[model samples]
Target chain A: MERSTIDLWVGIFVALGVAALLGLAMKVGNLTTSNIGATYTVTANFENIGGLKPRAPVKSAGVVVGRVSEIKFDATTFEAVVSLSVDKRYVFPKDTFASIFTAGLLGEQYIGLEAGGDDAKLQNGDKIIKTQDAVVLEKMISQFLYNKAAETPKAPETSGSTSSVVDALGANPLDNTTVNTTINTLDNKGKTDIAQPVAP
Target chain B: MIRSKLLTSAIRTLRNIGSRFTERIWRMGAGARLFGLIVVSSGECLRRPRLVVREVYFTGVMSLIIILVSAFFVGMVLGLQGYNTLQTYGSSEAIGVLVALSLVRELGPVITALLFAGRAGTAITAEIGLMKATEQLSAMEMMAVSPIARVLAPRFWAGVIAMPILAALFCMVGVLGGYLVAVPLIGVDAGAFWSQMQASVDWQHDILNGMFKSVVFGVACTIIAIFEGYDAPPTAEGVSRATTRTVVTSSLVVLGLDFILTSFMINI
Candidate 1:
């Protein structure tokens, strides 16, 4: 084979190889996205979202059914309007309750929809009226601690707050008074133990 | 007298710098020609299976054992380190995911390419340089035989074919390594680790990306080495210079290709 011909063939092969790899990658990616065909959009209103961010999974009965698409608050209601993308085909009854659920003990919070009665299926953009706000574990723990503290009673006070304790120690009562004269103090100093023993 | 001496010195420095710049330009031009020669030669070699097979055995298969061993240990270390971090959050199962991702995405291809560049790149440059110095290529042209088809083509093809296989081996070994460390050492169940690894990783993209990077690395190594070799000046000193340049250039190309491949593959 001619040298130039060979270079041409090699170049072709390289291009073909890249094309094949790309096609395979696209096929695989499509397979993953297509498997769960059913998707629905559900909205939840929260007074506070806390750390609940978008792209968080929307789960139903512990299985991830969709993801939170957006989070914003309405000007009139002053409530967070979180749009969740649930799989199509999985029908949400009209009275279904949407609540934020946390995975594990400290994992990211996601939207969890509980199936409700009422045979009518929820349409797109329909408001899920029954919505529960995010239950932050830390906040709950702090509240529990506060309630426990409130339940506890204070101990009763004792009589000798200050002065009685000082009297019990047997200090002289006249020395404690401000009215004692300087002459009275001088007389007691010589007669009592307050008088120093003078040696010859 | 002082002015004359200063003028002479200035003239000498200018002449020296000018010659050095010209020399660098010549070397670069020659390097580029050599690269073209390798691509041409590799094309020719594709028609001759015997020569290509011999080169593949020496360049590709021979390096497999060491590559696999390195990959295994790398995976094990990744698993050990990842387990420690994930353990704090009670998500130790992520150790497998970490190990597999690291090996397949980065370590395997980069390490194998570097090794191939050091070994195959050096050898190609030296062999081609020596051939050029001895006028074998000129002799082949005199005989109406194309040297590029027979010599350079095989090396390039071998590089392209060998890299992905080596990387795959690297990834496989790494997973086993991770298993070795995670299961017995860290008390993780083998079943759980393997299952988690399979579930978490998007296997198609990860494996395909690794293979894609390897082929690119292979082409880069082959081209750089061939370029340096074929472009070498017609002296023994030139051959040595070519060999050094081949190793340096190929290593840089491999790293540059890796960065580009990573950006495209992971969108990072």
Candidate 2:
């Protein structure tokens, strides 16, 4: 081959290589998706982060607005201090709730932000006070079993006690606080109603 | 008399083993010295960019067809196999992620290096060995020319430059091949296939690490080829033997280095 021919082919080869790397970066990799520019960092403390890893998505209303930058164990508080790199464009209220949530039935864990009604916006380096820990499957199952054992002795006294137990069992694990409160109210109402009938 | 003979034969066997071990270590030392000389004289290779470019044409441009063809077939196989398993778990949509991650993380760099070793590496060894056998390298030295700078350095730099490019092209082509098999052939949703891959495969972690691996493999394969050729006995049979050794040694070193690199990259 002539000198010019060799140079031309080498040029083409280098160009093709460069193009391929660009394609990998834009098309096959997360460079396009996870480029949250100009981020402000905020920290949240959780009693348990479960499997929430760094670089995990930080989503608000199912849309990723940031990423989990770092996770450190707070020795003083005995909690997980998770640093979130949220996009500067989206500002959250100071009282916003940060909770660890799984994507699907058995998927990776992420941090979800639920905006609360607060006049003040969360600034950079601000700590989110209202943070919920990840719901451990073992803990939820054990809690259900314990509730069942406690209700077994009073099963015969209530007319619609079985339905209440089913409600507790079917409650959403993600909304642990709301479910626990609802179950408590239902139990109290059942006890008061059964007591009135027995008085007669 | 029988006991004495047995002891003599045993001692002879031990001596043979010890000699072979020392010979291997001596060869390793010689190779390291050659590598140092190449690095020291790399300025000459860079000063004349055309020499490196010419070698790049011979090694990289020539090896393109085999690299691309093998990558496509490998990727298609990955898609077919991945879809077959993922569909059972109702996650056929994730076939793209599986293909992209595996290609970027392991297959692209490793397979490209293996193919390059078979194609360009053997050629380099044979060419250099033949030059030695023909006394051309000795003639250059007689003419006050550093053959390491004029010949081996250009080829070494060429291999180093070409490797990552070939691996990148391999990755791109492989992903396209997988896309063809998964989306149109197997009826996977194209959007989910691409979206999931983009969501999962981090560029810094996967793509850059893979490029780094290719560069390391390039250095290893090229250096071994050049060293073997330079060290070969100046004979026809010696040239052929050096070529074979180049392929074997390059393949083994590439695999071993890949494991070490992967372990280090994963921890990060």
True contacts kept of each: 0.00, 1.00
Model 1 share of native interface contacts: 0.00
**Candidate 2 residue runs with Cα over 4 Å from true position:** A1-3, A154-200
**Interface RMSD of candidate number 2:** 0.4
DockQ of each: 0.04, 0.73
lDDT of 1 by residue, A67-124 (tens): 7888888999898999988788677898999887777777678888899988998988
CAPRI band of model 2? medium
Candidate 2, residue A127: how far the Cα is off, in Å:
0.6
lDDT of 1: 0.73
Per-model chain B TM-scores are 0.84, 0.97
